[model samples]
Target: MASAIPLTRADMKRLADYAKREGVKAEVQIDDFIFRVSADHPPAKVDGSEESELDRELMEFDRKHGYR
Candidate 1:
């Protein structure tokens, strides 16, 4: 098994600052006693087809489940 690695407060602060500058959101998770950080943002909506496909799928699912 791998060992846990510890980070200083300065390191965490730097990461958060960088994320804010880049317009990214940060997520932190804990596994057992370990902590991890992740940054994410909404993916670029490529084109109309991609968005239309998503909407179509949602509409179909809703119709199937009687959510509409």
Candidate 2:
């Protein structure tokens, strides 16, 4: 049972506007004086077309160290 904080109309509108600009879903929750805001966004995709030099070196090191 957490404490909840009361937010004014202006505060709510500001938060909503921020969420809209970020292109993410916003969630707000209040519990016993606590106000929480969270954003949900998809994970970024990685390019795997070619192995970088550092990647190749790390792989070689892992093979030598017997790190599966």
Candidate 3:
């Protein structure tokens, strides 16, 4: 049985910030009803064009990772 753990607002906010800063890519189960956070995965080449700025940023990220 899975029991939900109550999280405080501060805990949730901190978790969100950590996810953003680390660019967390995925979560996978480690045990029954439990999961572990995975490292940031390699980004896929973006499709379509909308924001020039975002495109530029993605390019930069890829360049830094030698994915370009």
Q: Which candidate number has the best TM-score?
A: 2
Clashing pairs in 3: none
Candidate 1: RMSD over Cα atoms? 9.5
- Give the lDDT ranking, best first: 1, 2, 3
Clashes of each: 0, 11, 0
Candidates 2 and 3 compared: the better one by lDDT is 2
CA shift of 14, model 2, Å: 3.8
- Per-residue lDDT, model 3, residue 20, is 65
When sorted by TM-score, best at the front, the candidate numbers are: 2, 1, 3
What is the model-wide C-alpha lDDT for candidate 3?
0.64
- List TM-scores for all candidates, in order: 0.34, 0.37, 0.32
lDDT of 2 at 58: 89
Against the unseen true structure, what C-alpha lDDT does each candidate score?
0.71, 0.68, 0.64
Which digits, one per residue and each the tens of the lDDT, describe model 1 over residues 11-63? 77887777767777555554554434455666877899988999999999999
Query: What are the per-model C-alpha RMSD values against the true structure?
Result: 9.5, 6.3, 12.8
Residue 25 C-alpha lDDT in model 1:
59
